[model samples]
Structure formats: structure tokens, C-alpha cells
Target: MDFAFLFIDWLGKPLWMWLAFISIVIALLVFDLGILHRDNREIEVRESLALSSMYIGLGLAFGVWVWWQLGPESGMNYLTGFVVEKTLALDNVFVIALIFSFFAVPRKYQHRVLFWGILGVIVLRAIMIGLGTTLVSQFSWVLYIFAAFLVITGIKMLWIGDKEPEIGNNPLINFMRRRFNVTDEHHGQDFFVKKPHPATGKLVWFMTPLFMALVMVEIADVIFAVDSVPAIFAITTDPFIVYTSNIFAILGLRALYFALAAMIHRFKYLKPALAIVLIFIGSKIFIADLLGLEKFPAALSLGVTFAIIASGVIWSLIKTRGSQEAHSNGG
Candidate 1:
């Protein structure tokens, strides 16, 4: 076998580097599904936290390795991208919760939906990142477009504040219901079931509510990616760093969803903080141009990003501390 091709550069990184990253992801997925969660059960907050922590630790360790091998600049870029992507994905958790709730999906079946949804996300993000890298490499000015878009998005977030999506009125869901044979109730962990058609009395494949929830979850991620893909590209244009950091961050976030969804209302203030982060990230290019620097400092970006996200989390925890109790007590 001619393995020399592995040494060839694909997207500003050795082909093997991409392969190694893919291999790691596959192993993680296998271990996650084949071992850790082979059985369908409700993932408790404690278990979710532990799984999320392990994924986060592994992601951070990967950044350290990138730093050691690729240089501090690339390492810092990965960390920044990872942090930004993960923070942005918090909003995604809320949407997923809404989807599951609207569908009335069983807690035990939610993980299955999320697991498959993550698989779809991996593929979808790769395509988006690849297209983004191509655009940026061909036209350097596209970064500015992404920057401007991010700035506008951030401003919109600030102005609009947090609004729950009207999942019930979603056109896609309505279209799917009209076009496909969908079951009104869940069928355990199965996404599809063979059932007799109501009109024909013939066996047909019908999608369960579980499947509907999964589709909605995947669509929600794609919607969020519109903001996230550009945000990460604004950080660095390296496809390897952009894609790896994205997948890792998402993997951890999905694991954390079980816990976050239960307490999402407590983090009411995170949206504004995220808005600030986006504005800061988007403006970095223009700020650098104004200051006559080649680019924004990676270390400074990382530091500022961490500080903003940390402050938002702390502020949220403090402000919403008793809201949960109030709601529980019907106060």
C-alpha cells in the first residue's frame, strides 16, 4: 500500500492529521454507543456532568497536543475556537429541549435522538467548514463578510433577547407531517416502525415522534451553525483546527445537554454574554486593521473570551439562584 499519500497536504495539514482526528472521533463514538450507553435509559444530571467533563478534558488535552506540535499560535486558535463554539452551542441546548418537549419524547429515548443527531452534525459541519475554507482561501475579504455578519447577529441577539422558538409552527415539521407517514406517538427507541397504513391496511414504514424529534434537532443544529461556522472561521481559517475544535466542542455540549436542559432557565443572562463574545470576535479583524497589526493576538483573544464566558456563567448562577426554588414552590 502506498501510504506516502498520507504525508501529502490536504487542507494546510497533513492528510494523516485529518485521519488521526477522524479515528479519534470514531473511537469516541464507538465507546460512547457500543459501551457506555448501549442500553436506553435516562441520563442523570450527575452522569451527564461526568461524561461532559471527560469530553471537555479530552478536548482541552487535544488543544495542548496541537500547541506542542503545531506551535502556540495554532494551539491558542484551537482553544479559542473550542471555547467559542461550545459557548454558542448552549443556545442549541435550549432548542433541543424545546424540540423534545414539543414532541413529548421520553427521557430514555432522548439520548438516542441526540446521538444520531450528533452523527448528522459531524457530517454537516464538515461540509460547511470545507466550503468556508475554500471561500476564505480564494477570497480573503470573505472573512470581513463573516465578521460583519457575526457583528450584526450579535447585535440582533442583544436586541431581540431570548425568545423561545415556536416549534409547533415550524414549516418543516408541518411539511414532514403532511408528506410522510408519521406516528402520533413514540415507539420506544425506534425511529421508524412498520405499521399498517390507515387507508390501505398495508404494512408501511412510519416515522415515530422520536424520529421527528431527531429531525428537528438536526435542523436546529444547522440553524445554529450559521452563526458558529462563521464565528470559528473568523478565529482561524485552518480547516483542521476549525473542524476539530467544532466537533469536539459539540460532542461535549451534546453530552452536557441532559444537565443543561434541566436548568436552562437559570442561565438567562448567557445570551447577552454570548452576544458580546460574537461582537468581540467579529470586530477583531477590523480592530487589527485599524491598529495596523497583522492580526489579533491569539493569547489575548483566548483570555478575553474566557473572561467573558466565565463572567456570564457566574452572573447567571447568582441571579437565577432562587428562581428554580421559586418555580418549584409555586411562589
Candidate 2:
């Protein structure tokens, strides 16, 4: 009983309704990509733009559904979660780009792996969000736990998040390499690539494109989760909103990855923006108890966060331009 209280959302929802909704979304994804998109070999620039537009439209349509069904507050929460999660998700793009460069993953097949990996992220985050909401709702003190984690992460980010990523070697990955007979060369058009040996007459060496990419994706997702999971608490503690918003953001990540891969680093100020977001949300939680401001609303938090992020982006662009101009003049 205590475990149930601690881990599960006691709020009862209908079984049939859950199945119907999940099935409908899954069916739509299959229809769009499998049926309508199966003939396409590569996603082109115009296609990426169209997909991005479709993604935004899809999210807006979901927001409209929320507003109609739940009311304005729910819709606001969804939007806030969407913005914060989406912006933070961009950092993951930069890391994945670095990883691809490190592993020398070719351009064409990149989208396929990212598309599948991001889908996995959406599903996994849904479970985590559900469990988190249930915990926060029941214990309330988990809010403090998230707060403490954010403050620590914020201080660390401020101190070192700006450092350029070093992807030379990870011990965990090295260990995996030693254990498995990795192919000397990439086996293409395959996520679960495997091969047999003539000498041994068995599976000698094997790997999928997703193999290395999934590790990178998982690590990136976890790092972002440190900020994103806590930040959503600022929007609303309802697990439903957090999960739904996260899914919407992640579903667009493949398109976002292709669209922004080349220019992500130009926003040199993104680290600072994320740092501030973490600190602000952490401080928001810390003060709730001391100031007795549990009535803190998600709407105000969303607006304030949006403003902070916008300012950071504009500043970064201006700085990047100035630096480029200086370099051009041989300064």
C-alpha cells in the first residue's frame, strides 16, 4: 500500500480510454511514416521544412484539444512544458552531431537512426514522467529532491557546462567494445546489423547503426533530463502534461535534428540560458516552503522562462555576429 502510494498515481483513469488513445496515436504514426512515407529514401530540405511545419501544427492541434477538454490552465501548462522541453532538447542535438562526427556517421542514414531513437525517448520519458508525477503528488517532498538536484546541476553548469565537449573515449563504451566483436567497417542500411564468419560458421562480428547512436542518444537524453525533468515541475506537477509535452517535443526531434544540425553551435549562449533555467526553477522550489508560496502558478513561470530564453538567444546571435565580423577583419 505504501509502495503504491509512493510510486503510482492513485488518480484513476479509464482502461479502455487509455488503450484507445495510445492506439490512435500509434496508428497515426504508422500511417504517416510507414504507409505514406515508406517510398522516400532520404528526407530532403523541403521535406524537412514541411515536416517541421506539420510537427508544429500537430502540437498546436494537441494544445487546442487540451483547451477544449480540460480548460485554459491545462493548455497553458502544455505550452510551457513544450517550450522549455523543446529548447533544452536542442542541446542534445549538438552532442549527437559531435558524436556522429566522432564516429564518422555518414549523412544519409543519420535521420533513420535518430528517428527511431527519438521515438524510444518519447516512450521512455512517458513512463518516467508518469512515475515522477505520482511521486510528487503523493509525497510532495520529491519536489525538494528535484530542487536540490537542479541547484547542484545549475552550479555545475555555470561552472563548466560551457566547456567544449570531449568525445574521445568513454570508459563504458570502451568496455563494450572490448566485450563485443565490433565490425571494422560500418554495415549500412541497418540498425541491427549483424554478420556471420566463414571460418567459425557463426556470428563473428555485429552492430547496428543504432548501436553507437543509441548510446549517445541515451547519454544526451539523461543529461537533458537532469534539467528538463525538474524544470517541468515549475510548469505543473501533473505527470500527464509533462509526458504529453515531452512526447510532442521529442516527436519533432528527428526533423529538428536535420534542420538545426549545421547551426546549433552558433547559439553560443544556450548553455547560459539553460543554466539560468535550472537555477530559477531550483530557487522556485526552495522558496515554496520558506515563503509559503505553494500557490505559485505555472502560467507566470512559463511567461518568465520564455522571456529569459528569448533574451539569451538574441544575445548569442549578436555576439556570434560580432565575433565573425572581428575575425573577417583579421582582428
Candidate 3:
């Protein structure tokens, strides 16, 4: 049974329970903004690690509980979707790090902007999940289309290797720049510049570089969702599964961004692995109908994907280091 069927098959609490869950999520966000993260500063490693662990533990705990309540199968589906989304999101981290460096974002202010930026992404992806769920339920063929998109995306990623993203000429960024009196310098993690500085009272003051960075971040997220949403669809067509898993994964992203930022360059081969993972998922979705294999269990897929990513990352790190050492020592 696939996601929609699984939704019916799995017994869940009433609508009120779901409402309560959403309410709690909102409360968490409020607390994060109002209390936990009131002061804007560079996130410390220990704090980042704690939040990352907490978010991950919460997701896994929820998944396990779901497994106990629903069955191992659905639990696995949730985990699979979460893992895929999480791994794919790692690529985003690399780009974000580059963006920060490119714009010369101060370490202290980085988390402040990213925290809000990720919140926006959550809202956007939520809408996409709802839309995808509706579309997939009504038309079984939509799965094949999503599969095809992923395959094509994978091809593009592999064919175009080791180049910086071309965000400089993005139409939206250009247009926004032309219309607004954007500040050339960054403004302490402020996404938008309200107007002239209160002290200066000058008309030249406008949007800041941080705002531009936020737009770039959102643009990347949109492009990424195209590939990621389909990957999740392959795992399960239930919109709830896709949305919940994605949100849980994303909730940890800010912390992960900080924890993994320094090591991102070390995992140089991550993009190719992501491309391969996308192709794997896409092919699975595309061939399911042809093979009369309606069910591709999540645990198997998750295990295989994790192994592939780990191997690729480890190999790349070792090779990169070996090359540098060889050059230095004349081996």
C-alpha cells in the first residue's frame, strides 16, 4: 500500500490532536524567537549541537511513536522521507555557506537571518506539500511525472560539475536591486531595511545586503523543493507524511548549518551523491507501476541512501586530503 492508502490504513488520533500538534509547533517557534533566540549573535557550537540533537531526537521519537502506533512500515516511510529530505538539504548548507562567505556575513549575525529565512521556507514548503498531496491523490499518473522531473534534475546536477551557483544574474534579484535603494554593506542580519537610518535621516538608505541574501536563500529553497518534493512523493503520496517529515528535517537545519558549516568543504562530493540519490528515487517511482511493485519499503531505501552518501563523502574527503598531502611532501 502507498501513502494515501497508508493514511487510511494507519489509525490516527482525531483532528483535534493534529490541531494541538500544530499549535505546539507554533508555540515552539514563538519561544524560539521570543525567548531562546532573543539576542542576535553567532550561534555557539555547543548550542548548535544541542538544538540539532534536540530537533533530531524529537523527529526520531515522533517517527518511532508513529511506527508503534501505525506499524513499522509507515514509520519507515516517515523516516525514509525525512532522511532523503535531510540529505538533500545538506547540499543547501554548502550553498548557504558560500552565500555567507560571498556576502561576508559576520558569524555572530548569521544565525539570526537564517532562523527567519528557514521559517519562511517552512511556510512555503507547507503550501507545496498540500498542493502535491491534492494533485497526487486525484491523479495516479502524477507520480510518474514527478519521477521524470527528479531524473532530469539528477542528470543536470551530474552533467554540470563543480561550478558556483549563478545567483548573480537571477532575474528576481536584479529586479529587486534596480527598484530598491539597497545598501552595499550588510546590516547585522536585518533582512529588510526599513528606511533611512534614524540617525542619518538620508534618502540613500534602503534595503541591505542581508535582504538580498535572504531572497537568494529563498530562491535556492524553491529550486531545491522542486527536486526534494518529488523525492518525498516517491516515498509516499500522503501529503501529511511529506510535510511532517520535511518540517522536522528543516527544523534542525539552522543548527545543522552551524554544526556542519566548517566541514562542508570537506564533504566536497556531496552534490554528486545527492544527484545519485535523486536518480535512485526517481527510477524507483517511475518503474514501480511498470513492475507492478506498488510498495517500496522505506527502511530499505533509507539504508541504501545513507550508505551511498556516507561512502561518497568518506571517499572524497580521503582523496582530497591525500592529494594535498602528496603535493606538500613530494610523494
Candidate 4:
């Protein structure tokens, strides 16, 4: 086989680059499932933190590799997208916890749902990014629409505060419960089990609560992607960069979820900072137009985004410190 073909370009990137990323992702997944977690078991906070650190390290390392291959601008764009996606996923963590709680999924089975949910996300995000890439390529003006949407979303997030979704009354969940035979209790780690049907009086497969949690998690991912995909597009329109950054961020999120779920209150102020970040990204286009500049600096965008998120986390910790202390004392 000619190695020359591997060096050829696809979507403005060498084919090998794409292959390398896929190879890394596969290896990581294999290590995660086949090696590190060969058995289905409950993940404790300490173990979760360690896994999270490793995934985070791999993500940052990928950014460095991109810097070496793609140049500084692309590198900074990847970093920015990674940071934004990772933080935005904090809200996702909250929802996932709620889904698990609503379904009464045990801690032992939560990882199973999350792992399978990530698989769905990988496919779903690819389709969304591909569609986005095609749209942006055909109509450059769509960026403005995305920008406007982000600004509005950010403002709404700030104004509304954080209102948790009422997962118990979700129409989809209700429809599923009514339409299908669902077990009232979890059946170990299985998503489906053979049980006697109520109407048929025969053995048939019944959906378990674990499956419902997985479906909810997948739906939540699609919803969050609406905000996250546009947010990354504002940073860079390159499909390869956008897609890779997104996948890396999401890959680490499962691990991050375990760590964050235990202490989510500490980052209460991060949402406002995220809102500000969105507004800044949305307005950069207009700001550049006003200044007669071609584009806003990627480095500066990354810097400002880091600063905003950092400040929010630090401030939240400080503000919530006394309350946390009081709760601990009461406990």
C-alpha cells in the first residue's frame, strides 16, 4: 500500500491526521473498557477522579499534537473548544445525575449507561457537525445566526438562573412507559430482560430502567449539542478541529461526571461565566467588523474564555464556602 495516499488531504487535513485521531480514540476506549474497567463495577469518587485525570491529560496532549501539526491558530481553537465543551458539559452532568436518580438506577449500573450513552453521542455529534460544516460552507452568513442564538441563550441562562428539568414528567418517558413493558425495578446491569408480558401472558423482553436512563442521557446530549456545537463553530469552522475537540471533551465527560456529581454545588457560579463567554464569542464578529479587522485573535479568545471560567469557579468556591462548611458541620 502506498503511504502517499495517507498523506493526501481530506477536508483540508491530511488523511493520516484523521486516522491518527481515530486510532487514539479507539485505543483510549479499549483501554477504558477492555483493560482498566474489564468488569462492570461501581466507580467511587477517588477512582473516578483518577480516571478523569487520565482522560483530561489525554485531551490536553491531543491539543499539543494538534499544535505541532496544524499550527498555532488551529491549536488555540482546539483548546478553546475543548475548554468550552468540557465546562458546558457540567450542566450535562447535573442532568445525568437526575436521570439516574429518576430511574432509580444504582451506582453500579450508572457507568454502564454512561458508557453506552457516549457511543450514541459519538454518532450523533458526527452527524450534527457534518450538517453544520455543510451549512457553514454553503452559507457563510449562518455564523451570524449561530452568534445571535448563542448570545440569546447566554442571556437566558443568566436571567433564568439554573432550573433543573422535570425529568419525571418527560413526554418521551411517559410514552415509552405506556407503549412498552417496562420493569418497575432494575434487573442488575442489563438494559433488557426476559419477563412475562402483562397482556400476552408469555415470556417477552422487557425494558429496564437502565435503558430509560440511557435514552434520557442520549436525548440530553442532543439538546446540549445545540448550544455546544454552535459555540465551537464560533471559534473555528474547520470540521476536523470542531469534531475532534468535541469528541475529546465528551470522552472525558463520563469520568468528570462522577467527580463533579459528588460536589456540584461548588461550581454554582460557573453558569454565569459560561453565559459571558458565549456573549463575548457572539459579539466578536461585530467587534471585528467595527474595528475593520479581518477576524478576532484566536489566542485572545482562548485567554478571555479561560479567564472568565476561572474567575467564576474561584468566586463560586469563595461565596459557597460558608454554606458548605455549615452543611458539613450539620452533617
Each prediction's RMSD over C-alphas, in Å, is 1.5, 5.3, 5.3, 1.1
Instruction: List candidate 2 stretches off by more than 4 Å.
Output: 1-24, 35-42, 194-205, 208-210, 322-331
Among these predictions, the greatest TM-score belongs to: 4
lDDT of model number 1? 0.93
lDDT of 1 by residue, 92-135 (tens): 89989999999999998888999999999999999999999999
Flag regions of model 4 displaced more than 4 Å: none
A best-first ranking of the candidates according to their lDDT comes to 1, 4, 3, 2
Which digits, one per residue and each the tens of the lDDT, describe model 4 over residues 33-106? 78877788878889889988898898999999889988999999999999999988887899898998889888
| Candidate 3 segments exceeding 4 Å error | 1-13, 194-205, 321-331
Q: Rate the local accuracy (lDDT) of all candidates.
A: 0.93, 0.72, 0.78, 0.91
Candidate 2, 61-158: lDDT as tens digits? 88777667667888888887887787887778888888788777777777766766777786668767777878887898888888888778878888
**Deviation (Å) of 231 in candidate 3:** 0.7
TM-score for each predicted model, relative to the true structure: 0.97, 0.85, 0.86, 0.97
For residue 81, give model 1's deviation from the true position in Å: 0.5
Candidate 3: lDDT over CA atoms? 0.78
Give model 4's TM-score versus the native structure: 0.97
